[model samples]
Target: MFLAWQEIKKNKLRFTLITGILMLVSYLVFFLSGLATGLASLNREAVDKWQASAIILTDESDKSLYQSSMSIEQLNDIKAKKTAVIGQLNAIASNDDDKQNISLFGINKEEFLMPNVTQGRAFEKANEVIADESLKDKGFKLGDTLSLSSSDQQLTIVGFTDHARFNAAPVLYANLATFHQVKFGEAADQKKDQINGIVVRDDSISKLTQNDELDSIEIESFIQSLPGYTEQKLTLNFMIYFLFGISSIIVAIFLYVLTVQKISMFGVMKAQGISSTYLSWSVVAQTFILAFIGTTLGFAFTLVSGAFLPAAVPVSFDLTLMMFYGLILMVVATAGAVFSVLTIVRIDPLKAIGG
Candidate 1:
C-alpha cells in the first residue's frame, strides 16, 4: 500500500486523469439507474399501492387488465378474505385549453383499493374524483372541474393522492357508478355491472379454484404485463450493463499502461531484493485505491444531480441499489488490474535494469 501510494504521488497528473474518467463513467451509471427506477415506478405505482397478493382477471384477457371484464355475478362466484372490484379506462381530462392523459380507475370508496387522500378529502358524491398529486404539475387543483373528452360527463377533483400513477400517467379515482356512467354514457343503466378485475390477498387467492373463466396472476406478473413496462426496463438495464463493461476496460488499460511504464523501476527494486509478489500486490492496491476514490466521488455527484433535477423529470435514487452496483464496480475494477499485476510479476530484473 505504501509503495502504491508513492507511485501515485509521483505521477499525480496521470493518476488524476484516470480517476476522473472512472468518476465520470460511474456518475453516468448511477444517474441512469435512478432514472430507470423512477420510470418503472411511474408504470406501476398505483397497482403497487394496492399491496394485493394477486389479481383475478378473465382467463381470456392474457393477464392484461385493460382487456379483462367481469360481471358482478361472476365477481360473487369468487371468494376471498380481502377483495376489491376495480374498473380501468384510459381517458383524457381537459380543463379549458389544458389537457392531460389519465388512467381513470373506478373503485368503491369503501374498498381497500381506495387510496387515502393526501390533500383535501376523499370523494363523497357522484362525479367527484380523487387524483394523483402529479396532476398538479399540469395545472390541476382541488375543486377544479375536469371535462371528459368525447363525453358530456364532468368531474370535480375533490382530493389529491400521493404516489398514485399508472403507465406513466396520472390516475383519477372515481366511484363505480360514476365510472359506469362515464364509460357507457346513456347505456350505463342498460348494461350490467362490469369490472376490469379483482384485487385479492396472496394467501386468500389460493381459495380461488382453477376455473375456466377466471385466472389468478401474481402482482409482480401483473405489473410486468403493463404495456412497455418490461421493454423499458430491459433497454435501461442493457445500457447500465454496457457501462459496467466499459468501466472495467478503462481501468484495465490505464493500469496496464502505468505498469508498463514502470517496468525499469520495478526491475531495479527487484535487483535490490524486493519480492515480485509484493510488487504485484502493490499494483492491485493502487487499482483499488483509485477505484474507491473515483466511485465515491461519482456517487456524491449523482446525489447532488438528483437534488437539482426538476420534479417533472422522473429520477429516483435508491441507496441500496446504488451501493450494490458500486460494490460490483469495485470488484470489476480490481479484476481489471490482473493484467497489470501479471506484467509486474514477469519483469526480468537483469534485462530491464540493463536497458
Candidate 2:
C-alpha cells in the first residue's frame, strides 16, 4: 500500500487522468441505471404500490392487464388473504385546451388498492376521481373537471396521489361504477361488475399457476409483462454490462502501460529483496484506491446531477443498487490489475535493469 501510494504521488497527473476516466465511466453507468429504474417504476408504479403477490387474469389475456376480461364472480374462486378488483383502460383526459394521456383505473375506494390521497380527500362519489400527482403538470388540480375522450362522460379530479403512474402515464383512479360508465357508456349497467383482473396478496402463488380458467402470475412477472418493459429493461442492462466490460479494459490498459514504463524500477526493487508477491499486491492496492475514489466521486456526481434534472425526466436513484454496481466496478478494476500484477511477477531483474 505504501509503495502504491508513493507511485501515485510521484505520477500525480497520470494517475489523476486515469481516475478521471474511471469516474466519468462510472457516472455514466450510474446515471443510466437511475433512468432505467425510473422508467420501470413509471411503467409499474401503480401496481407496485398495491404490494400484491400475484395478479389473476383470464388465461387468454396473454398476461396483459388491458386485454383481460372476467366477471366479478371469478373473485369467489380466488382464496387469498387480500384481493382487490381492478378495471383499466387508456384514455385522454382533457380540460379546456390542455390534454394529457392517462391510464384510467377503477377500484373501490374502500379497497386496499386505492391510493392514499396526498392533496385532497379521496373520491367518494361516482364521476369523482383521484389522479397521479404528475397530472398537475398538465394544469389538472383538485376540483378540475376532465373530459374523457373515450366517452361523453366527464370526471372531476377530487384529489392527487403521489407515485400512481402506470405505463409512463398518469393514472386516474375512480370507483368501478364510474369506470364501467366510461368503458361501456350506454351499456354501462350491462358490464357494471366486469373487471380487467384481480390483484391478490398473501397467497401461495404456486397454487393458482396451473389453473385452467385463469392465469395467475407473480407481481414481478406481471411487471415484466408490461408492453415493451422487458425489451427496455434488457437493453439498459446490456449497456450497463457493456460498460462494466469497458471499465475492466480501461483499468487493465492503464495499469499495464504504467507497469511497463516502470519495469526497470520494479527490477531494482526486486534486486533489493522485494518479493514478487509484495509487488503484485502493490498493483492491486493501487487499483483498489483508484477505483474507490472514482466510484465514490461518480456516485456523488450522479446525485448532484439528479437533483438538477427536471421532474418530467424520469430518474430514480436507488442508492442500494448504485452501491452494488460500485462494488462490482471495484472488483472489475481489481481483476483488470491482474495483468499488471503478472507483469510485475515475471520481471527478470538483470534483463529489466540492463535494458
Candidate 2, residue 230: lDDT: 90
lDDT of each: 0.90, 0.92
Runs in model 2 deviating more than 4 A are: 208-211
* lDDT over C-alpha atoms for residue 46 of model 2: 93
Model 1, 201-309: lDDT tens per residue?
7575666745679998889999999999999999999998998989989999988988898889899999999999999888889988998999999999999989999
Tell me the tens digit of each residue's lDDT in model 2 across 180-244: 99999999998888999999987588775355789888999998989989999899989998999
TM-score of each: 0.97, 0.96
* Candidate 2 weakest ten by summed lDDT: 202-211
Which candidate ranks first by TM-score, i.e. highest? 1
Model 1 steric clash total: 0
lDDT, model 2, position 201: 88
